[model samples]
Target: MNKLSLFYLLVMVALIQISVPAITVYQNEMVLYKGSEFLFKTIPLDPSDPFRGKYVTLRFEEEEFETLDTSLWQRNESVYILIDKGVDGFARVKRLSRKPMSGNSNYFKGRIKSFYLADGKAIISLDFPFKRYYMKESKAPRAEAAFERALRDSGQQTFAVTHIKNGKSVLVDVKIGEISLKDVVSESKND
Candidate 1:
């Protein structure tokens, strides 16, 4: 092909490649800034993935939902989890749906980790999309230690601050009470 044609082709390919990630970042930024915020109670532990590096693995208390029809859901199926604030102000699963809510924006996408019948009700365990809060290699171990200590204390509250909009969610921060986990680690270092 002509050099001018080749140049145009390469430029088109490059634009297409860049646009995908650009759109993703834009969407995530929008969610972080303009989306509704929810606090999800967390039980965390530290783990290192060889490919992804160090992160605090988060398990939410609001991962299970019960329904009467077990046949409607399947393992590993993508689902929309509708959330609403509980009496204590933490996010709770309001319902699950196969399709996105038409007029509501208070849902995030997740997968069904597993399900089982119990007392004729289907108990579904969900796999949240945002489960890893990555930290610098140096800070992760300290953060995990502090998180565990906070979790052990009955009075301390550990939770993740997440923002959700249009089926997308961003994990803003993990906090113990009003202080963030990063701040907690930093404070421990100062002590």
Candidate 2:
């Protein structure tokens, strides 16, 4: 192939590699937004990345599987987890199954972390798909600081707004005390 042709091919390949995941994420998010929305309580931490800008590290509240049967469980095993709103109005894991079930409940695909025990409970650690919510560089710091202050206040709660569809999940927003991070930053600007 000609040098110019080869160069163009390389560039196209690189672009595809970079853009495919981003495009997939956007598409998945759109699906989630159009589907069922769920809430999961979270503890947020902020950190900056040179390439991806700043994002909040999300640790979900429902990481422990209270009634999981470990007999058939294996390290790094893939599982389909059912999601339903709890009495507190937060989305929580209803069950883990080897295959996705059809019903009104939402589901997400996750992997089981290696065998472990905690507090006399047979814990099944889950690795959720969406862990970080990327934010604009300028706004991330403000959001982080606000979240930290809210965390210190006993009245505030931090939670992630997640949406699920067809066993796919997306993190739509991170909220502090019922206000979204973006809105909180904008509200601060008016004060």
TM-score of every prediction relative to native: 0.92, 0.78
Per-candidate alpha-carbon RMSD to the true structure: 1.7, 3.5
Per-residue lDDT of 1-191 in model 1, one digit per residue for the tens? 99999999999999999999999999999999888999999988889999889999999988977877667678999999999899999999988899899888999999999988889888999999988999888999999888777768756999999999979999999999999999999998998
Off by over 4 Å in 2: 1-26, 117-121, 189-191
Top TM-score hit: 1
lDDT of 2 by residue, 58-175 (tens): 8887876776354557889998889889998998887888887886548888898755665655578787877888987788778877778778876587889888877788888989
**In candidate 1, which residue ranges exceed 4 Å CA deviation?**
50-52, 68-71
